[model samples]
Target: MPANPTLYAYLRGEILPYDQAFLHVSDLSIQRGYGIFDFLKVENGQPLFMEHYLDRFYHSAQLMELAIPLERSALQEAVFHLIDKNNLPLSGIKMILTGGYSLDGYQPVEPNLMIVQQPVTMPTQEQLQKGFEIITHEYVRDIPAAKTINYSVGIKLLSQIKAAGADDVLYHQGCVVSEFPRANFFIVKQDDTVVTAAQDVLKGITRKNVLEIAGRTFKAEEGTITLQDIDQAKEAFLTSTTKRVMPVVKMDGYAIGDGTPGPVTLALLEELLKLEKHSAQR
Candidate 1:
């Protein structure tokens, strides 16, 4: 990880030294677990899909009723300023809005906003070539539509998932596939149809773009994906800001398709990388 003592962060309305950006223990986000945050990548000192992420951040805050103390324009300025201040060639930027410190450590108060810039490494090409397996847990997020700062159920299963030789958890209710802990899930049918769950999903930015790419290159559908459907899938993959497009080789203990990255999976990855390159250049 890249680290510099000179890195700056935005706290509330003030730009401060990174180490000085601290919150009171009694803040609602700390005491009552009330907060909303969004993270996206920066390439060549430019943030990608920042406007889309910021829109989701505001909507998440609205869903939790945790008011953000800054307007969109002000928040954007703060984020850009921090990026310039940090100046990491590649990084992941997180924008957070917390329900303010409460006198009783319960009720909401004026919110605290923060922009944290951190150096990050993209997933390795070797990891993608070998692909990764994911385990399914019978769980669903509290609010599937909102990107709120709550990951209790997902993170709690970290040990269980890792022990199973998996990279992540795909949450489902009964036999119907919903989504992964932090990413969107998709599977290709025997007939090469790309299908992903539309409802009960976080609607990730990477997911949105992949669906568009699939529509142009292959047949794409958004609907219910059951375990039975997965069993019959020719390919499977997960999408997220960090992972981009990741092939899923196995589910539970069963090998998906031929236990290798399928043609459709590779094609989408290639196109997505091209898109990423274009974004980086611009």
Candidate 2:
């Protein structure tokens, strides 16, 4: 891997190198995980569907009672600045909005803005073709709809999931399947219905697009999915800004359908890719 290049971080209106973008040690976002953020895909040099991501980010920040000091357009420009500064071909951009510095440790201030641009690389074709196996965990997220930083349980379970020979973990409370560590989950039925959780999970951008397109071709529903639902699924996959539409052939030592990517999953992938390609060109 190329040595991680130095990337720029924008704080308030100031641009600083990564190491210089420091937060107060007592910031509530660090002490209590009181922060909200968003991620989006950057192709060539532009962030794809950035406005949608920013809208959601602002919503999450507002829900958490944090104030963004910059306009959405200003934030988008900051991302472009980092892209050019780092000379990145493909990248992932993130903006962290937190209840800024507090000497009292609990007092709130205007949100601190931290923007980062990092190199983007995908799993090799060999890795994708082999498919990823996932482990199911019993952890649950608090205020699941908000993209906050209090992700202790999800972060803690990753190693155990990887040790179990899986690329990720699907957290389910008893029969209720919530979501993956950082992606949304989906399952296909023999009848060609695509099902995934409606709430208590991040409403992924790719997930939204897949549902919109699937409306024309196959049955798609956003409702509660359980471990039982996934175990019994005819096909399964996960979606995210990075993963896009990925096939999950197994979970927790059990084969998903016939241990292969299913027809519905492939069809949605093809359709989603075409839409994204067209959107990029526009």
Among the numbered candidates, top TM-score falls to: 1
Model 1 Cα lDDT, one tens digit per residue, 1-282? 343568888897899888778898988888988888999899878888777888899889899888888888888888888888888998989988888888888888898888898888877978988787989999878888888788998889999998998888899899999999889999999988999998789989899889989999789989999999999999999999998989999999899999888899889988888777776412
The list of candidate 1 runs beyond 4 A from truth reads 1-4, 280-282
Residue 14 lDDT (model 2): 85
The sequence of per-residue lDDT tens digits that candidate 2 reaches over residues 1-282 is: 333437676776788877677787777888777888898877786678777798899889888888888877787777778777876778888889888887677888767888877777876667667778998888678878888888788778878976897889988887898898699999987788888888688888889989888888889999888777776789999988888888999988989999987788888988988877766512
For all candidates in order, the CA lDDT equals 0.87, 0.82
TM-score of each: 0.96, 0.93
* Superposed model 2: Cα runs more than 4 Å off: 1-6
Q: How close is candidate 2 to the true structure, as a TM-score?
A: 0.93
Work out candidate 1's RMSD over C-alphas. 1.8
